[model samples]
Target: MSAKTNEPFTEEQWLKFVQQKQLKFVECQDCHKMSVIPFAVCTTCGSRNITWKQASGQGSIYTYTITAVPPPELQAIAPYVAGVVELQEGLRINGIITGVENVNSYPADLVGKTVSIEFLELDRKSILAFRLNA
Candidate 1:
Protein backbone atom coordinates (compact mmCIF):
# COMPACT_ATOMS: atom_id res chain seq x y z
CA MET A 1 0.00 0.00 0.00
CA SER A 2 0.93 3.64 -0.40
CA ALA A 3 0.91 6.61 1.93
CA LYS A 4 -2.42 8.34 2.18
CA THR A 5 -0.78 11.67 1.39
CA ASN A 6 0.48 10.43 -1.98
CA GLU A 7 3.81 12.17 -1.52
CA PRO A 8 6.13 11.92 -4.55
CA PHE A 9 8.96 10.21 -2.70
CA THR A 10 9.48 6.48 -3.12
CA GLU A 11 8.33 3.96 -0.51
CA GLU A 12 11.90 3.29 0.55
CA GLN A 13 12.44 6.95 1.40
CA TRP A 14 9.17 7.14 3.23
CA LEU A 15 9.91 3.94 5.15
CA LYS A 16 13.33 5.24 6.05
CA PHE A 17 11.70 8.35 7.44
CA VAL A 18 9.26 6.21 9.37
CA GLN A 19 10.30 2.69 10.40
CA GLN A 20 13.88 3.67 11.05
CA LYS A 21 12.45 5.55 14.05
CA GLN A 22 15.29 7.99 13.74
CA LEU A 23 14.36 11.64 13.67
CA LYS A 24 16.43 13.15 10.86
CA PHE A 25 17.21 16.85 10.77
CA VAL A 26 19.30 19.11 8.56
CA GLU A 27 22.14 21.13 10.01
CA CYS A 28 22.99 24.29 8.14
CA GLN A 29 26.71 24.53 7.52
CA ASP A 30 26.44 28.30 7.38
CA CYS A 31 24.11 29.07 10.28
CA HIS A 32 24.58 25.87 12.35
CA LYS A 33 20.89 25.65 13.16
CA MET A 34 19.19 22.29 12.69
CA SER A 35 15.91 21.93 10.85
CA VAL A 36 13.37 19.11 10.66
CA ILE A 37 11.50 18.07 7.52
CA PRO A 38 14.74 17.57 5.63
CA PHE A 39 15.45 19.81 2.68
CA ALA A 40 17.97 20.17 -0.16
CA VAL A 41 19.29 23.50 1.12
CA CYS A 42 19.33 25.30 4.41
CA THR A 43 16.24 27.43 4.72
CA THR A 44 17.91 29.75 7.22
CA CYS A 45 21.27 30.40 5.56
CA GLY A 46 20.50 29.23 1.99
CA SER A 47 23.42 26.82 2.17
CA ARG A 48 23.46 23.56 0.27
CA ASN A 49 26.03 22.11 2.63
CA ILE A 50 23.37 20.78 4.96
CA THR A 51 24.02 17.45 6.63
CA TRP A 52 21.62 14.95 8.20
CA LYS A 53 21.79 14.10 11.87
CA GLN A 54 19.76 11.69 13.96
CA ALA A 55 17.83 13.50 16.66
CA SER A 56 17.94 12.47 20.30
CA GLY A 57 14.17 12.11 20.14
CA GLN A 58 13.79 14.20 23.24
CA GLY A 59 11.70 17.36 23.37
CA SER A 60 9.30 19.58 25.30
CA ILE A 61 5.83 20.78 24.51
CA TYR A 62 6.13 24.35 23.30
CA THR A 63 2.44 24.86 22.54
CA TYR A 64 -0.65 22.86 21.76
CA THR A 65 -4.42 22.81 21.20
CA ILE A 66 -7.12 20.26 21.83
CA THR A 67 -8.45 19.09 18.50
CA ALA A 68 -12.19 18.55 18.69
CA VAL A 69 -13.01 18.50 15.01
CA PRO A 70 -10.78 16.33 12.89
CA PRO A 71 -11.20 14.52 9.59
CA PRO A 72 -13.73 11.74 9.42
CA GLU A 73 -10.98 9.16 9.67
CA LEU A 74 -9.80 10.90 12.83
CA GLN A 75 -13.22 11.62 14.31
CA ALA A 76 -12.98 8.41 16.29
CA ILE A 77 -9.92 9.89 17.91
CA ALA A 78 -11.53 13.18 18.86
CA PRO A 79 -10.45 15.33 21.74
CA TYR A 80 -6.86 14.45 20.98
CA VAL A 81 -4.10 16.89 21.84
CA ALA A 82 -2.12 18.34 18.96
CA GLY A 83 1.00 20.23 19.88
CA VAL A 84 4.25 21.69 18.63
CA VAL A 85 7.21 20.15 20.38
CA GLU A 86 10.57 21.87 20.65
CA LEU A 87 13.10 19.13 20.15
CA GLN A 88 16.31 19.11 22.12
CA GLU A 89 18.12 19.63 18.83
CA GLY A 90 16.17 22.92 18.45
CA LEU A 91 13.60 21.98 15.84
CA ARG A 92 9.86 22.11 16.38
CA ILE A 93 7.36 19.60 15.00
CA ASN A 94 3.59 19.24 15.24
CA GLY A 95 2.48 15.83 16.49
CA ILE A 96 -0.07 14.03 18.58
CA ILE A 97 0.68 13.13 22.19
CA THR A 98 -0.37 9.65 23.15
CA GLY A 99 -0.59 7.54 26.40
CA VAL A 100 -2.39 10.32 28.19
CA GLU A 101 -5.84 8.84 28.68
CA ASN A 102 -7.71 12.00 29.49
CA VAL A 103 -6.80 15.30 27.89
CA ASN A 104 -9.02 17.31 30.23
CA SER A 105 -7.92 15.60 33.40
CA TYR A 106 -4.30 15.83 32.42
CA PRO A 107 -2.50 18.61 34.25
CA ALA A 108 -1.38 21.72 32.44
CA ASP A 109 1.95 21.15 34.17
CA LEU A 110 2.55 18.51 31.52
CA VAL A 111 3.88 21.24 29.29
CA GLY A 112 7.63 21.74 29.19
CA LYS A 113 8.14 18.19 30.40
CA THR A 114 10.39 15.83 28.46
CA VAL A 115 8.90 13.60 25.78
CA SER A 116 10.16 10.88 23.44
CA ILE A 117 9.12 9.60 20.05
CA GLU A 118 6.44 6.92 19.70
CA PHE A 119 5.82 5.59 16.20
CA LEU A 120 2.18 5.01 15.31
CA GLU A 121 0.63 2.77 12.68
CA LEU A 122 -2.30 4.08 10.72
CA ASP A 123 -3.83 2.92 7.46
CA ARG A 124 -0.70 0.94 6.52
CA LYS A 125 1.45 4.00 7.08
CA SER A 126 3.71 4.69 10.03
CA ILE A 127 3.49 8.06 11.78
CA LEU A 128 5.73 9.71 14.31
CA ALA A 129 4.16 10.47 17.64
CA PHE A 130 5.29 11.46 21.13
CA ARG A 131 4.48 10.83 24.76
CA LEU A 132 5.43 12.50 28.02
CA ASN A 133 8.45 10.92 29.61
CA ALA A 134 7.91 9.00 32.81
Candidate 2:
Protein backbone atom coordinates (compact mmCIF):
# COMPACT_ATOMS: atom_id res chain seq x y z
CA MET A 1 0.00 0.00 0.00
CA SER A 2 1.28 3.42 -0.91
CA ALA A 3 1.48 6.11 1.71
CA LYS A 4 -0.10 8.56 -0.71
CA THR A 5 -3.50 6.96 -1.05
CA ASN A 6 -6.16 5.99 1.44
CA GLU A 7 -7.22 2.88 -0.41
CA PRO A 8 -8.48 0.04 1.73
CA PHE A 9 -9.67 2.56 4.21
CA THR A 10 -9.16 0.95 7.56
CA GLU A 11 -7.68 1.79 10.89
CA GLU A 12 -4.78 -0.53 10.12
CA GLN A 13 -4.02 1.33 6.91
CA TRP A 14 -4.13 4.58 8.80
CA LEU A 15 -1.69 3.17 11.32
CA LYS A 16 0.54 1.98 8.51
CA PHE A 17 0.61 5.48 7.10
CA VAL A 18 1.51 6.84 10.47
CA GLN A 19 4.15 4.19 10.84
CA GLN A 20 5.69 5.46 7.65
CA LYS A 21 5.88 8.89 9.23
CA GLN A 22 3.43 10.24 6.69
CA LEU A 23 0.97 12.72 8.03
CA LYS A 24 -1.94 11.78 5.84
CA PHE A 25 -5.50 12.83 6.46
CA VAL A 26 -8.79 12.29 4.74
CA GLU A 27 -10.34 15.38 3.16
CA CYS A 28 -13.91 15.48 2.07
CA GLN A 29 -14.28 16.62 -1.51
CA ASP A 30 -17.77 17.93 -0.97
CA CYS A 31 -17.39 19.94 2.22
CA HIS A 32 -13.63 20.19 2.07
CA LYS A 33 -13.43 19.04 5.65
CA MET A 34 -10.33 17.29 6.88
CA SER A 35 -10.03 14.62 9.54
CA VAL A 36 -7.04 12.86 10.99
CA ILE A 37 -8.87 9.58 10.78
CA PRO A 38 -10.56 8.27 7.67
CA PHE A 39 -14.24 7.59 7.64
CA ALA A 40 -16.71 5.93 5.29
CA VAL A 41 -18.49 9.24 4.86
CA CYS A 42 -17.85 12.84 5.70
CA THR A 43 -19.50 13.65 8.95
CA THR A 44 -19.93 17.28 8.01
CA CYS A 45 -21.83 16.75 4.75
CA GLY A 46 -22.44 13.00 4.52
CA SER A 47 -20.28 12.84 1.46
CA ARG A 48 -18.70 9.55 0.40
CA ASN A 49 -15.97 11.22 -1.57
CA ILE A 50 -12.85 11.71 0.44
CA THR A 51 -9.25 11.99 -0.63
CA TRP A 52 -6.07 11.49 1.27
CA LYS A 53 -3.95 14.59 1.72
CA GLN A 54 -0.44 14.65 3.02
CA ALA A 55 0.45 17.24 5.60
CA SER A 56 3.68 19.22 5.83
CA GLY A 57 4.44 17.81 9.28
CA GLN A 58 4.75 21.34 10.61
CA GLY A 59 2.56 22.59 13.40
CA SER A 60 2.33 24.49 16.65
CA ILE A 61 1.39 23.13 20.00
CA TYR A 62 -2.16 24.06 20.83
CA THR A 63 -1.99 22.67 24.35
CA TYR A 64 -0.13 20.03 26.31
CA THR A 65 0.01 18.17 29.59
CA ILE A 66 2.40 15.89 31.37
CA THR A 67 1.18 12.33 31.77
CA ALA A 68 2.66 11.39 35.10
CA VAL A 69 0.53 8.28 35.10
CA PRO A 70 -0.39 6.85 31.74
CA PRO A 71 -2.73 4.02 30.94
CA PRO A 72 -1.69 0.45 31.66
CA GLU A 73 -0.39 -0.07 28.13
CA LEU A 74 1.72 3.09 28.18
CA GLN A 75 2.98 2.79 31.72
CA ALA A 76 6.42 2.00 30.41
CA ILE A 77 6.68 5.52 29.07
CA ALA A 78 5.00 7.28 31.91
CA PRO A 79 5.70 10.87 32.78
CA TYR A 80 5.77 11.78 29.11
CA VAL A 81 4.44 14.83 27.35
CA ALA A 82 1.49 14.66 25.03
CA GLY A 83 -0.55 17.36 23.39
CA VAL A 84 -2.69 18.65 20.62
CA VAL A 85 -0.74 20.15 17.78
CA GLU A 86 -2.39 22.47 15.33
CA LEU A 87 -0.99 21.71 11.92
CA GLN A 88 -0.24 24.43 9.43
CA GLU A 89 -3.13 23.14 7.37
CA GLY A 90 -5.48 24.01 10.20
CA LEU A 91 -5.92 20.51 11.52
CA ARG A 92 -5.28 19.51 15.09
CA ILE A 93 -3.92 16.07 16.00
CA ASN A 94 -2.96 14.48 19.28
CA GLY A 95 0.47 12.96 19.60
CA ILE A 96 3.22 12.20 22.09
CA ILE A 97 5.72 15.02 22.43
CA THR A 98 9.50 14.65 22.58
CA GLY A 99 12.43 16.91 23.52
CA VAL A 100 11.21 17.85 26.95
CA GLU A 101 13.86 17.28 29.54
CA ASN A 102 11.46 17.11 32.44
CA VAL A 103 7.80 16.24 32.17
CA ASN A 104 7.25 17.61 35.66
CA SER A 105 7.17 21.38 35.82
CA TYR A 106 7.59 21.68 32.09
CA PRO A 107 8.02 25.13 30.55
CA ALA A 108 4.86 27.16 30.42
CA ASP A 109 5.75 28.33 26.94
CA LEU A 110 5.16 24.83 25.59
CA VAL A 111 1.84 25.99 24.28
CA GLY A 112 2.17 27.47 20.80
CA LYS A 113 5.60 25.92 20.42
CA THR A 114 6.62 24.82 16.95
CA VAL A 115 6.78 21.09 16.31
CA SER A 116 7.28 18.50 13.60
CA ILE A 117 5.76 15.08 13.21
CA GLU A 118 7.83 12.11 14.32
CA PHE A 119 7.35 8.39 14.86
CA LEU A 120 8.25 6.42 17.94
CA GLU A 121 8.73 2.66 17.83
CA LEU A 122 7.14 1.15 20.91
CA ASP A 123 5.79 -2.30 21.55
CA ARG A 124 6.79 -3.23 18.01
CA LYS A 125 4.60 -0.56 16.54
CA SER A 126 5.07 2.96 15.35
CA ILE A 127 3.38 5.50 17.55
CA LEU A 128 2.72 9.02 16.39
CA ALA A 129 4.94 11.55 18.06
CA PHE A 130 6.02 15.17 17.70
CA ARG A 131 9.42 16.74 18.08
CA LEU A 132 9.64 20.18 19.55
CA ASN A 133 11.34 22.60 17.23
CA ALA A 134 14.39 24.32 18.60
The estimated TM-scores of all candidates read: 0.75, 0.83
Error of 1 at 116 (Å): 0.7
RMSD of each: 6.3, 3.2
Q: Please write out the lDDT profile of model 2 over residues 97-120, one tens digit for every residue.
A: 998876677666788889998988
Clashes (backbone N, CA, C under 3 Å), per candidate, total: 0, 0
Q: Candidate 1, TM-score vs. the true structure?
A: 0.75
Best by TM-score: 2
> Model 1: per-residue lDDT, tens digit, 9-28?
33355447776665676667
Worst 10 residues of 2 by lDDT: 1-10
